[model samples]
Target: MKRKSSKVLWIDAPDIKARIEHLVEKASIDWVHTERIACVRSGNSSARAYARIWGLNQVWQQVLDVPSYYCIEVLSEKFDHLPEHHKDEILLHELAHIPRTFSGALTPHTRRGKGSFHDKLKQMIAAYARSFR
Candidate 1:
């Protein structure tokens, strides 16, 4: 029997879910067992895409006591039409923000000489190379 699909608001499409799942699997980040990934539509016109880390805030730690979630917000107008390669790149970039700890905390990006973009690019290249061998 086929499995039922999870409900995803805003960007509720099969292709979007598949892309997210593929990126999450490839990311290999150690999110807590209960962590969830959601793709939402971005309301900001200037935003192309961004990953929002949830459950890491003080309220969650002090009250909810639950694992964090990663909400990947894609610009409804832009992301839905991007090429597959571009989507992959964007997803990979977001995944890179996640630390290996998977403890619901984020690895803050550095803006100094070797910035987040540079670091993410390096990691992406390495992962790409490993896929071939």
Candidate 2:
């Protein structure tokens, strides 16, 4: 069944839950339901800086007492600028780590399909950025 899109007002204007849901759908997976998921700007990040460490094309999290999973944080900048499809791709990348999944998480130090999955996701972010610049 197709999931209906919902706008998350707590987050920035561009951070519609629909985009995240779209990503989940594209990956042929489902997002774990949580009551207080939030998408916000990185505390010390800005657009002027490179996106790899912190920018519109990146995201990070601070895990708390929840042992199985932590807070899933996406940069407001990166959350706003990606194309629809690529946004979905990024969502898939992040969602791949949801509980049980074979692909699991992509490690930077390891290679996949002749190239690192990390590099490929970076390429996706870069490509998404280049489309605007």
Candidate 3:
């Protein structure tokens, strides 16, 4: 029997990082705490991108040894194929998951309630639109 490798390849793509920086500035969100953005090829196809509190787990920290408030992972193939605006939208959506507190933690989406993920997405879109004006 063959064992499946759990290791993921993380690529530092400056172009993607630049886009994230522009989006953060335009969103007027204090994301200076974000330490890194990397492209990853996930086995799951439905996932476009995601953000999470980085280095919070001691065991994983010992292995990776990087300190960061947030780590955004863009699914390599799917994210790369998107248009610029779509990429921005997806990245913005992931960033919206971070709370205003700027702590190294994630604000999980409401599963089935008033303040659902969709609500947050709508608010993020509205804010992004206002940033241009």
Candidate 4:
């Protein structure tokens, strides 16, 4: 009998990194400029989302004695098949998870039971579009 392997491989994604930097600048996401962000693409992920943003939580930061950081990983299978504008929207949506504090904590879909994450994302996407004009 042959056994199946399910190893996921992650590789540095310079293109995604560039896009993120451009988005941050164009959308005027000032809080992101100060945070350390790493971008990567993964293969063989079974997750349903096109991309995911991972945070270096406070507990890990304290334990490792390191500064806060975030990782933007796009699932190659789904992400590569998407159109450019959709890719930008996906990235922008992931970026919306970072709170203004940039403290390595993720902002939920509904923030603090008051602010709506999608509202901010829509505004940012609009700002990103208007930047080029």
Candidate 5:
């Protein structure tokens, strides 16, 4: 019998990192520690999302004996083909996941108050637009 398998490759994405830095600055995402964040691209991944945020939780930080850090991952299959504006939106969405505390934890999509995650994301998109104009 033969088995099928998939391979995933992760590589540092300095270009994406640079883009994120610009977005962070333009959007005034003061809560995020841009320096501590890392960006990586994955090839041949099965994830359906355009991008995702991976965080090192407090426990992991303690276990690893390191400070808080975030990894923004872009799946090449989904993200690489997107338009520039779409890519920026996706990047901002991932950045939104990092809570204001910058404690290496993710903020949930559901909010306790009136607005939702999309609401915040929309504001960010608008801000990103207004930035360059």
Candidate 6:
């Protein structure tokens, strides 16, 4: 008998931008415009968390410097492993960071220096990630 290889569902840029619009509208923020979205292969040297943020920064600068660009860069390996529902959750969580970035209120994921909001944000993100699985 032959074994079947698992195929991961990928989220495209327009879908991501649409989701961002939904989240932003729900959050009562002004509209965000995106210029483009593209995926580039990542090297092993970078941390996944940091790389994700770096991808967001790339969008931020490319679209507009001042406006926060909602983006995600899943590890190619992990991207291949993620199920569809989990992808939705992650996209939403990453979009949640946009308002903070745009407003200049963004902070590191660390818990010690910040208050409950940041921690709560992380918790909610984790919850979202878990809820789909």
Question: How are the candidates ranked when ordered by TM-score, highest leading?
Answer: 4, 5, 3, 1, 6, 2
* lDDT of candidate 5 over 1-133, digit per residue (tens): 6446678899999999999999999998888888999999998787779889999999999999999999999999999999998899899999988888899998889978746888788888888889989
Give candidate 6's error at residue 75 in angstroms: 3.5
For 56-92, candidate 3 gives per-residue lDDT tens digits of 4444545677543456677775666778777788877
**lDDT score, candidate 1, position 58:** 43
Report the lDDT of model 2 for residue 71.
34
Regions more than 4 Å wrong, model 6? 1-12, 23-51, 55-70, 99-105, 111-113, 117-119, 122-133
Once fitted onto the true fold, the runs of candidate 1 whose alpha carbons sit more than 4 angstroms away are: 1-9, 27-35, 43-55, 111-117
Residue 83 Cα positional deviation in candidate 1, in Å, after optimal superposition: 1.4
Ten contiguous residues minimizing lDDT sum, candidate 4 = 26-35
Ranking by lDDT: 4, 5, 3, 1, 6, 2
TM-score, cand. 4 vs. native: 0.92
lDDT of 6: 0.46
Superposed Cα deviation of residue 103, candidate 6 (Å): 4.1
Model 1 C-alpha lDDT per residue in residues 43-96, reported as the tens digit of each score: 434433343433355467567776566555666666667777777777676666
Clashing pairs in 4: none
- Write the residue-wise lDDT of candidate 2 on 47-91 in tens digits: 342122111111322223332222345555555476766555556
Please report, in order, the local distance difference test score of every candidate based on alpha carbons: 0.57, 0.41, 0.61, 0.92, 0.91, 0.46
Candidate scoring better on lDDT of 3 and 4: 4
- Give all TM-scores, in the order shown: 0.64, 0.39, 0.65, 0.92, 0.92, 0.43
At residue 5, candidate 4 shows an lDDT of: 73
Stretches off by above 4 angstroms in model 4 are: 1-5
lDDT of 5 at 75: 95
Query: Between prediction 1 and prediction 3, which has the larger lDDT?
Result: 3
